[model samples]
Target: MKANVGTLDRGLRIAAGLILIGLSLSGVIGLWGWIGVVPLATGLFSFCPAYSLLGLNTCRNRPH
Candidate 1:
């Protein structure tokens, strides 16, 4: 998969994911916080399935 997630987007995703995971681990948000794994994986992989389904791409160099 091409990198549909840009640098800023990826950074934010990673940060948010970490925060959610941290909160979950700390018992501040319960198991639902584990959902952060989705964003974390997408950020690290630079691809978002939902974005693809919605025909959206954040990468600047995406091909036409």
Candidate 2:
């Protein structure tokens, strides 16, 4: 899949995912924190399925 998530967005997702996972491990947010894996996967893959369905593209133009 194409990279629909931009650099900054990807960075934020990674950070948020890590934070959430950390909190979950520490029992700070209960089991809900484990949901962060979704963002983490999207961030790592640089492609969001929801974004594609919504026709959202944050990636800047570049020679392909």
Instruction: Give the number of the best model, judged by TM-score.
Output: 1
Q: Please write out the lDDT profile of model 1 over residues 1-64, one tens digit for every residue.
A: 7779988999899999999999999999999999999999999999999999998898888896
lDDT of 2 by residue, 1-64 (tens): 8889999999999999999999999988999999899999999999999999998888886336
Off by over 4 Å in 1: none
TM-score of each: 0.93, 0.92
lDDT against true structure, model 2: 0.92
- Alpha-carbon shift of residue 48 in model 1 (angstroms): 0.2
